[model samples]
Structure formats: C-alpha cells, structure tokens
Target: MKKDKPKYKQIIDAAIIVIAENGYHQSQVSKIAKQAGVADGTIYLYFKNKEDILISVFEEKMEVFVENLQQIIEIDASASEKLFKMIENHFSVLASDHHLATVTQLELRQSNLALRLRINTILKNYLILLDSILREGIENGEFEQIIDIRLARQMIFGTIDETTTTWVMNEYKYNLVDLTPKVHRLLLNAIKA
Candidate 1:
C-alpha cells in the first residue's frame, strides 16, 4: 500500500514542538516525523529539508498574522486605539499559542545566519504596520512630529519583543494581555505630543 502524503501544516506544527523541545540544532527530520506521527520519509515529500520547514512555518504563521492585523487596523478609529489594538494583537496571539511562541522566540533564532535573515524579511510587515500607526499619530498631532519614525518604530518593536520573550522565558507565569495597556502607555510617552 502507498503511504499517505503527509499534511504540510501538520508537519510544520510538529516541527515547532520538536524544535521548541529539542532546540533547532538537535531537531532532525526523524524527530519531526515522530512528533508529527508520520514516517520519516513522509517529511521529505512535503519539505526539501529542515530549513525549508522552518521557513514555511514562519511564512505561514506570519501570513495569518498580517491578514488579521490588517483587518483590525482598517476600522475607523484613532491612531492611539489602533496602536493599542496592534500591540494587544501581537502579545495576545503569541501568548495564546505557546508552542508557536516558543518556536518563534527561541528555537527559530537558533537557525544559521541565512535563515535568520529570511525570518527578518518575513517579519518586516509587522514593523511596517507599527511605523504606519506612528505616522498617523504624528499627522494627527497625537505624537511628536519631530520624533524619528525609524527610532520610534524600533522602540515599539523592541519593547514588545523583549516583553514577550521575557514572558516566554519565564514559562508564561503571568497574564500577557495585562501588559498591553502598559506597553501602549510607554509607547505613547515616547512619541506623544
């Protein structure tokens, strides 16, 4: 009997767990196959190699993230409200998906330089959205017009990233959603008019 073609997403999901548990360097194809409950050979059918699997995971998750965030930001609302929603969405999504959060925050960063660069490109959309919100705030006189957009973007992204990573590292002992308001406050302090 012919073996079934493995589900690509299932493989990717399993890869996240295996990578998170074992670390990226130690996560072999066989480990992913085992975690995914498919034969080792089945992985080759879906992905060219481990690198392909990692890249696919990032791309797929980010696609969903950008789509949802785009819709939320499009609603008629002030820049501050939009910024709060953006920060909340980012924190909530990752906090809700612990496995994916671990994979992204810890495991994926273990990949070699080339893979890291690709991950950065995939994540650029999120940064762009943050910058757009900052621009809107500046335009509406809600934020300091003289603030450097790039620097403000970095601060926003960096703060959220560090906060999430810290939460993950601590095994998510606290409510991440609660941090959204505080994060929004600090961001506003830095850029607000």
Candidate 2:
C-alpha cells in the first residue's frame, strides 16, 4: 500500500505540523510538501487535494491510537483499570506530541460538515472499544447496571476530549498527563456500582 511508502509517512507527519501551525484553511499544500521535504507534485501523487491530506493525517494517527487502545483492552484487568489506563494513554500520547495534540484538538475541529462526518466515521472504532469496556463493567458488576452506556461513553470521551482541548488552548503550560488520576477518578465515581 502507498501508506507503507516513506513519503506517505513523511507527508502525514508534515501535514500535522503544518496544520497545527497554520490553520487548515490557511495551510497550503506546498507548505506541507516543503515540510515533508518533497516536491509539491509528490503530494498530488498520494492525495487528491489539501482536504485529502488532512483526512489522511487523521486516519494514520487515529489508526495507531485505536491500536494502542485495543492493546489496553487486552490487558488482564478490571474494566475500571482498563479505563484508567486508556485515559492515561490518551493523555500521554497528546502530551508527548504537542504538534499532534494541536492538530487533533484544535485544527481537526475546524473542518466542514462532510469532513467532520468522515472524521466521525474514523472515531467510531475508538468509541466501540469504549463501549466494550462499559459493557464489561456492567456485566462484571463494576458499574451500576442502571447507567446508560451511551451517555456514559459520551461523558467519558467528552471529558477526555475537552480536557485535552483546554490544555492545548492554555498552550500546554500545565502537565496534562498529571490530570489522568483525577480524571479517571471522576469517571470511575460516576459509573461505579
């Protein structure tokens, strides 16, 4: 697949930086090419246009993100433990990469409706994993059976997403990963049986 090609990875990485630095509307394909160390034409070979590059950037990174979450799911632990780890993992990934954090939390949200839909489709896999954790918690009597799984899922994801967005908006002055414990505890309390 073209994704395995070095240029593809380079372009994706470059696009993240470029998008984060330059708003998606302001980010030009040539700037991305320059950041990727390739000719502008090379970008065309892999992407249909600027929008395609943005989507591809999210796709590549989210694939890895979901994969890591899947690994967390496989660990021999209670659903609460898994949820804590997942929250930690999410915070760690963004905190470790400022450019990626800015791109995902800020830049990605500024897209059109169609683009948002495409991004939402990519996000479903992550949500499905979250749902599994919630279901397991209910089945194992770790979470209150009366809890609405869908609302709980939204709350968990929203809290995580909004926390990261706030950190990003604050220019990352605070240690985001440090909030993991408190965030985990709050979510845990909300769902615990």
Candidate 3:
C-alpha cells in the first residue's frame, strides 16, 4: 500500500542519499527525513525503522531493475545478446547514478547477517533472470553444453557486482560503463559453445 505512494519513493530515494553519504551505520532516520523534506515521524508511517528503509530501497530499485531486464530479455534476440544487454544495462544504470551505485555496491553490503539474508532473498528474483538466460543459452547451443548453470549465474552476477563495487570504491575515476563490453565478452566466452 505505502509502496505505491509518492512519499514512499521519496523516502526510499532519500534513504539512498543519506546512507550513501553517511554510511548506513551512521545514517540516522532524521537525516533521511531531512533529505526527503519530511518530518522524522513521517518516516515511521512508511517504514518500521532504518533497516526497513534499507530493505525497501533495495527492493524498490531491484524491482525496477528486474522489470527492465525482463523487457530487455523479451525482445527477439539470442540468449547471448540478451546476456550482453543485461551486462551493458546493469553497468550503464549504475554508472549513471553514483549515489545508487554507492548505496547498492557498497553501503548495502555492510549490513548485518540478517539484513544480508533479506537482501539475498530480494536478490533471488534477479538471479533467476540470469539463470533463465543461461538456460536459454545452453538450450540454444549458444553456451557450452557442459556449463553448469548455477555456477555460471554466480560467476556472471559476482563479476558484475564486484566490478561495480570496485568502481564505486575508487570514486568512479574511470567510465564503468566502458567496461561492459569487455566484461560481457569474458563471461560469454567462458560459456560460449
């Protein structure tokens, strides 16, 4: 219900900036409220606490991310092309939004075990998309028949995740999006038939 409200998105975007700037541990609810231009008490109406805000931020961003990926994959193209587009799109979006890049690639990883578990749960749907791509590749002979789908998904996701994290940690010195081709090629080559 609240997720559909304009204020909900406002708080989520505000939480990203606050958490990115202050680090999640140091980001206070009041800071997020100020960033969102809402009263601190107003945050509670949408979120239960700071952890809720963090989770919601990830959930909201990933929902959009997965939706975009689904649309990208649905186009009439080979699995390899879809996978390339996935890598390219993922890098481009994060490269364009430094705050989101920092929050997703860095701040989100600093949470506690329970929080990480929840984050992983949210991440499952995204992984399933990757798995579907890999399966398609194998079925169509675009990828090697011997390639293990699960391991391939992990490698693809981990490579992209770590690459973005490194770029964010380095303060975006170079064009992260530029690395997409090379990353995509490397991952594709590993599984190519």
Candidate 4:
C-alpha cells in the first residue's frame, strides 16, 4: 500500500513557516523537519531536495488558487467585473495566509537560478489566466484595443505583487483587503477602452 501523503503536506506547511521566518538561505531541512515534527530523513521521502519542496509548495498552492479563481470568474459577470473580482480574490487569498505570502514574495526570490526558473514556469499558469481576462476585456470593448495584452498582464501582476510585498514587509500592519478598490482602479484606468 502507498504510504500516507498527509505527512508530506505537513512538512511542506512547516517548511513554509521555517523558510518565511528564516529566509531560504537560512532555512535548513533539519529545521523544517523539526518544525514538521518529523525526522530529517522523512522529508527526503517526499521531496528530492530543498528546491523540490519550494517548487512543490508553489505548484500545489497555485493550482488550487487558479482553480478557485477560474470557478469564480465563470459566474455571470462583465469582463470588467471579472477582472475586479480576480484582483480582489488574489489579494485576499495572499493576505489571509501571512506566512505563505512571505515565503512566496520574499524568501522564494532567494532561491538559485534553476529553482527560480521552475517557479516561473509554475507562475505562468496564473499569468495566463490574467492574460485571458485581458483578452476577453478587449474583445468585449471594455479594454482599449491598442493595449499590449502581455504588458497589461505584467502591469496587473506587478502591481498586485508589489502591493502584497509591501504589506508583508510592513508586518501586515494595514488591511490588505482595503487596497483592492484602489488597485482595481489603477488597473482599470491603465487598461480602459
């Protein structure tokens, strides 16, 4: 019989905390093992190395995030409204998970080039979803026809990423949800038809 996978998840969760708190360079597998309440050898059972864990964390979380966002966007709504909802949901999800946000926004950047490239591949799915929305907006005449779809997608992702990174750096002192409308306005203005 296959061994249970719950322990792997538990280890990954603990690794997020450890990496977020210690930064990637300082986060050791032994530290993650202790945080996860398992032996160091146990982590190897689930992941080949630290890079694997980091990549897995992003892949798993982002898959769920995209899946949920896709469902939310499918509701009856205008493209503009869908865009707004997507931004709101994106920020809200990250804000709700402080540790994950830190790991993703800051610690993850410290990974080596190969790992960063892997993470980028995982991130493209989310970017593609954003791009699709922009395309829809242009099609529906809600977004300006001349706007470069890729640039618009980059701006949206960059703005939200910067905002969240700022919030995380501030120790999350301010309410992130409160910034949704402002971000939405900035994006809408930049892409409006």
Candidate 5:
C-alpha cells in the first residue's frame, strides 16, 4: 500500500539521484527527502532507513529488468535472437538513464557486505530470467549442451555488468548501447553450439 503511493516512487527516484551524485556514504535521508520535495519525515513513511531506501531502489528497478526480460523470452524467436535482444534490452535500459546507470553500476557496489548480500538477493530474479534464456538455448540446440547453466549465467551476467561498470567508470564517453551487439557476439560465440 505504501509502495503504491506516489510519494514512495518519488522518494525512490530521488534516492537514485542523490546516491548517484553524492555516493551512498555521503547521501543522507534528508537530502533524498528534499530532492523528492517532501518533508524529511515523509521518507520514513515508506522506508525504514537510508539502507532500506537503497535496498528498495534496487528491488524496484530490478523488477523492471525482470519484467522486460520476461517479455523477451515470450517472443517467438530463436535462442540467439532472444539472447541478443536481452543484451540489447539490458544495455538500452542502463544507457537511457545515466543517473540510474551511475547509481546501479557504481554507487550500489560501494555498499557494505550485508547490503551487498541483500542486493545480490534482489538480483537473483534477474539472474533466474537469464538462466531461462540459457536453458532455452541449450534445449533448442542453439547453445552447447556441455555448457553448465550456472557458469554460463555467471559469465553472461558478469560480462554485461562489468561492461556497464566500465562504461560508467569512463564517464560514459562511449556509446554503451552501441556495444550491445559486440557483447552479444562474444557471449554467443562463447556458449553457442
């Protein structure tokens, strides 16, 4: 119910900007509230604390990633085509939002181990969706049946994540979306039968 409130999304979006600009350690709850144009106390209505806000940001954004990937799976296409679209979708989502890219790629990784664990748990849904793509590929003879699903998932996710991180680190001077096809090619070559 609280999450369905407009102010909830406002705070989350504001938190992304605040965290991306100020870094997680330097970002304050009041700063997020101010950015959201609400009183500092309003943030408490939806989140338990600053950490909760950070975790919520990941959970909320990851839902979109999972949902989009789900649709890609449903489209009538070969595993290779599906995988290419998945990479393009991933890159496009992050590339289209530089602030979100900064928050997810750089800011989020700066958290403590406990926060990392929580973030990784939120990531599992996205990874599971990726696994479905991989499994479909293997089943349809598009990918090598000898490939281990878990390792293949890790390789694919890790490659996508690291490439995005590198782009962020370089201040996004390059066209990240343009790299999608290249990433897809390398990943496909690695796993394709």
Candidate 6:
C-alpha cells in the first residue's frame, strides 16, 4: 500500500508546507513534488490529485490527533483534570508545528463543502473523544446535569479551534500555549456544575 512507502509520507509532509505557503488553490502537484524532492509524476503514483493529497494530510494528522488525545483521556485523572489536559494537548500539538497549525487552522477552512464534509467525517472520532470527557464530567458532577453533549462538544471544539485560527492568522505573534490556561478556565466555568 502507498501508506507504507516513504514517498507517501514525504508527499504528505511536503504538501503541508506547499499548501500552507501557497494556499490550497495555488499549490500545484509540481510544487508539492519539488518540495518532496520527487518527480511530479511520482505524486500521482500515490494520490489521485491535489485534493487527495490535502485530504490525506488531514487524515494522517487527525489520526495522530486522536491517538494523542486518547492517551490523555486514558490517564487516571478526574474528568475536570482530564479535560484540562485535553485542551492543553490540542494547543501544544498545533503550537509545535507552525506549518501544520497554519494548514489545519486556516487552509482547512477554505475547502469546498464536499471536501469539508470529508474532513468532518475524519474529525468525528476526535469529537467522540471530547464527548467522552463531557460524559465523565457530567456523571461525576463536575459538569452541569442539564448540559447537552452535542452542543457542549461543539462549543469546546469551536473555542479551541477559533482561538488557534486567530493565532495562525495573526502570524502566531503571541504565545498560543500560554493562552491554554485561560481557555481551560473559561471552558471549565461554562460546564462546571
């Protein structure tokens, strides 16, 4: 399978930088191939086109996202503490890689409806992780008994997402990780019983 080949990862990583620097619409297969140090035709051996490359990048990154998040969720901590760590993890992961952060926070928002929907489907697993935390919180009396899980998941994801997007759009001029505590506190207050 292409996923097992070195060029597959090479192209995916290259596409992140190409897409981030060039914007999704402007980044071409040739540019991605050049960035990956592969021939333009080599790209086709792995992907159908540019759209496939973008979707693949998102899929790979979000898979890691869910894995890291699940590890945090599995830690033996209170629901509130676990939630805090989860928030910290999301911000830290993005803050560690500027190109990845830029592509995820900005370029992802530019995809057409169909592409966005596909990304959303991949994103559902991450949402379920958040849902688990909320359920734990509510069961343990850390969160409001009346809160709706779906709406709460949206709010938490939106707040963290928007906060990071603004940071990316502003050229990451400030400390994104530094904002995590405040965000955690605000989110905690919103859901706390």
- Per residue, candidate 2 scores C-alpha lDDT tens digits across 89-159 of 99999999999999999988999999999999999999999999999999999999999999999999999
Which residue pairs show collisions in model 3? none
For model 5 the local lDDT of residue 103 reads: 93
TM-score of 6: 0.98
List candidate 1 stretches off by more than 4 Å. Answer: 1-6
Task: Give the TM-scores of the predictions, in the order they appear.
Answer: 0.93, 0.98, 0.98, 0.95, 0.98, 0.98
The candidate with the higher lDDT, 2 or 6, is: 2
Q: Write one digit per residue (lDDT tens) for candidate 1, span 37-111.
A: 999998888888999888988988888778777876798898899989988988988988898899888888778
CA deviation > 4 Å runs, candidate 5: none
lDDT, candidate 3, equals: 0.92
Candidate 2, residue 6: lDDT: 75
User: Which segments of candidate 2 are over 4 A away from where they belong?
Assistant: none
Clashing residue pairs for model 6: none
Off by over 4 Å in 4: 1-4
Which number leads on lDDT? 2
Q: Flag the better candidate by lDDT, 3 or 4.
A: 3
Per-candidate clashes come to 0, 0, 0, 0, 0, 0
- TM-score for candidate 5: 0.98
Of 2 and 4, the candidate ahead on lDDT is 2
**Where is model 4 poorest over a 10-residue stretch in terms of lDDT?**
1-10
Q: Per-residue lDDT of 1-193 in model 4, one digit per residue for the tens?
A: 1125779779888988998898888889999999999999999989888888888888878887799778766888887888888888888888889989999889888888999899889999888888888888899899999999988888999999999999999999999988989999988999999
User: lDDT: which is higher, 1 or 6?
Assistant: 6
